[model samples]
Target chain A: MTDLSGKRILVVEDEFLVALEAASMLAEVGATVVGPAYHPAPALQFAKTEALDAAVLDINLGTGTSESIADTLKSRGIPFIFATGYGQLAGVDPDAVVIDKPYSQAQIVAALRHVLA
Target chain B: MAVVPQKDETRALLGLTDRLYRAQGLDDVYAAALDAIAVMLDCARASILLFDDQGAMGFVAWRNLSDEYRSQVSGHSPWQRGETQAEPIFVRDVRDTGEPDWLKAALAREGIVALGFVPLMANGVVVGKFMTYFGDPHDFSAHHRELAVAIARQVGFSLERHAAEKARSEAVRDLKESGDRFRLMSEDAPIMIWIADSQGKCLHLNRMLRNFWGVPDEVGDFDFTSTLHDDDRAAVGAAMAAALRDRQSVTVKGRYRRSDGAWRVLETTARPNFSASGAFMGMIGVNVDITEREEADAHKQLLINELNHRVKNTLAVVQSVARQTFRRDGTGDLEVEAFQGRLAALAQAHNLLAAEAWQSASLEEVARRSLNGDADVRIAIRGPRVELRPKQAVTTAMALHELYTNAVKHGALRSSEGRVELSWLTAEAPRGSLVVRWLERSPQPILPPVRRGFGSTMIEQALGADLNAEVEMDFQRSGLVCTIVAQLADTVRQ
Candidate 1:
């Protein structure tokens, strides 16, 4: 029920249905959605070029890891939470929040809100 | 009255008696006896004969006697066989005696004009006789006959002592030789071998075992448990003690540190050894190294664990996809059908992954498998062989399934006249890239949908996110065309 009015958030996830559901949930909270980049390169491109208030990143993007994208968001001071099926993320920043896969919409949105705060 | 003995004769008699007692072997006894006979009495020749099991007398020692004379006259004795109390036979002259003609001729040939035979006694039994021959016929003195009797008694006792001594020494030599042979064989053996006494004291260790333990050859009374790994020491020691107490053979496996400080797995088998009288003597053992086999077993266990983890993760992903598909507004049988199709696509990808040991799958193969329900004539797939890692293959299969579903519902595969061309090629880019194109040609005009559905979102967003690809889907009047370009080298895991 937290107000995400006028907040711009970028979502990066590999699964199409999962990413779409996550994007729709953010839109319902009144947050404008950016590219739900399926691959790391596009996600990195979005992280560098787009105007983002926050980001939701799937740790594994079928092609490789989203570590480069995570790095970009950190450097830009954009708050983000990691979404993954893995128990541990190798070479990832320890301070970053993680949301396990098959997560509920509430879980994703709340984790993002907490990271953004 | 007895004549007083001369000083030289008395000294000679004393020296001969000392030599008879000091004789070490049968040969020494024979030599000492011959010297005594020559020194004590006047004789042309002397011989000693002993009776064998068959009661036949054979000359064992002789002095200055021809082989022909000894052979011809050896059996001619004054007393019959087993005559233990017979008195000496004195032949004043061989020609005058009532002996056989051949015996007289043989004695005459050797110049024995007179001969005296004195019986030898051992343990109060007459065992043999000694003969003294004089060149000229003479009357026998009672003193000379008494001296001959004393010489035979000394010689007879010495022969018995020498025989016993020889048998004892031979037995000792045989035992030593057998022990030496056992040591030599153990030293050359490739496997570790050891022997321990009845009290569990180490008696011997082979060369291989010594080198493995970094111990010297002469090291004695070692406890093998000292070298055992800490975890296995107590148990192994207890098993060894139990086996020893039971006097039974035992086989055990344990870890022991080698000379280089590496712990190696060893299987040891010890068997109890016993004496001829069935007394427990000791144990002999052999050790074999099995470290490599143990390592291989551990590695297989680790792989099984990893496989279990992967299977659980895959199931979670499937669950997520199902929940998302059913959560959509106005979702019904059609949505269920789509979900089932996606699941089938995921299963096909897993099959390909399994076939390749979960390493990589061929891109062309995944495309063909995803579009399986469509007739062969409706879909044309053209692509060079390109292998994708497991993750890439699964994501690509889901994307292809969505594309096929759309084609069947609203695009090319809706009508018999429709056809879809799927082709992919690798391009040499900075990171090396692959470009896959799905071109649909339908007889009916294709129209762009007013709202983006799950299929379009998957073909564009999910495909790009998973593959790090640039996706473009065009809804043209003629057909629905989709183009995907992804970095090939960056996506594959080494």
Candidate 2:
């Protein structure tokens, strides 16, 4: 198994099953998973108030976009990667790593490692 | 009667010709003709009459004639309007001739007992006449008759010349008016318009085109092709050349440079123009700017890409649900793995189809994706270029995945010396059918499965129904062979 011990990662997804799967995958690798915020309000709150090592954000929430959350993470110097079902994201940081949907645990872990490194 | 010499008569005739030559208009000509009649015929009252628009002779100019007398004798003509070869009529006494009683009474009331009528000739046809009246009953002399005919000929020729001049001037005015109207319409048109000469040189460009090219009012030698973008210039030129050669109307599109150096797509339609005599003149064309429409089409394509992304994301969510449900049921690891493998195969097919905007997917690409990085020297794949529709593409991908997995786990790859060959070709037995064969050669024969599994069921039942195909799996003493035959028309793209 891939080791992510001592890592505090924020997981943000709107779908319940996808969020549960992502959190489980992160916990299995020994990382402390933060709030799997399903909405933009809580996601922004976590980005602003929580002490974090990194974050994985689904580019879109149920009602709104995760742009504000991504912006908050950026201001705090938190390493982050974007996950999206969209082929491309508009008005986001171009340099940010993007993981396409239906991604495996291996792909997410590899991207997270690269961002953290 | 006092005798008048021929010499005096000749002088009066020459003087009448000089006055007629100096006449300015129809009124002036009539005044001169009436004067000549009185002097030549030696009469106190005289008049000039001509054909009116209604083809009746009406008095145009006269002297010393009563209105009552003129009204009673109006429209009286011995010859028709177009009659040629007629002689003059002289009535020395109205009472002695076959004259209407009303006319003779009117003439008697005006104290006119005798009169002379000389027919006017214009272009070899009699148009009207000149009349001379004498108060006294008199004898008609040949010299007096000759003088009247000579004066009538001069006045007729002069009237015809005036009519011709009037017609020519009116035609010139009408031509100028219509030309002005055409210029006004073309200049104010919203789209670019141009007129070219027979040699394809642009002779005129409307105000819109002038502003588009940033040219001056006088275009002079400006070449329209110079404004065409470099990449599209040749194609537009060829199309225009062909249209001109064939004398056919043409519509062509190309990118053109605007005055501000921005490129815009313009659709131009041109047709050959001909003169009234059917001689080829040139071409007249209009250009419509379509840059905005082009941008809108590109935006639509971007939206399609975004929609495809959303569909793939939905599929991801379903995969997550399946994983969670399978884990809670204490499902066997093998079953979960198999389900995930099937989902991945479906997604792989979607990726290929989406890349081509969901039109079709390549068969070779489907096979390679199903191999999932295990495609090595031990396995050989050979086939002609083939394309599959969306439904068949997904089914074929999943079926290939099962076959590849089975061969690796149990059949060909299970032995070091094992090899597998997968090939497809069009079948001759059934028209428009394709056959795909999977032949595995193992050093030792493998035992066939005793019971049918999900893999076989999916390959045989689902794929066969979806594609209208025939599926056969034979486990021989030598090796395993699998063949699938499907109607190309239903499952494959030609």
Best by DockQ: 2
Cα displacement (Å) at residue B333, model 2:
2.5
lDDT (Cα, tens digit) per residue for candidate 2, span B171-260: 879877885677678998999999888887888889999999898988898888888888998888888888867879999999988899
Error of 2 at B417 (Å): 8.2
Runs of candidate 2 with Cα error greater than 4 angstroms are A48-53, A67-79, A87-98, A113-117, B1-303, B376-380, B413-420, B427-431, B440-445, B476-479
Fnat for model 2?
A: 0.57
Query: Which consecutive 10 residues in model 2 chain B have the weakest lDDT in total?
Result: B485-494
> Where's the lowest-lDDT run of ten residues in candidate 1 chain B?
B304-313
lDDT of 1 at B222: 68
- Against the hidden reference, what TM-scores do the models get? 0.36, 0.53
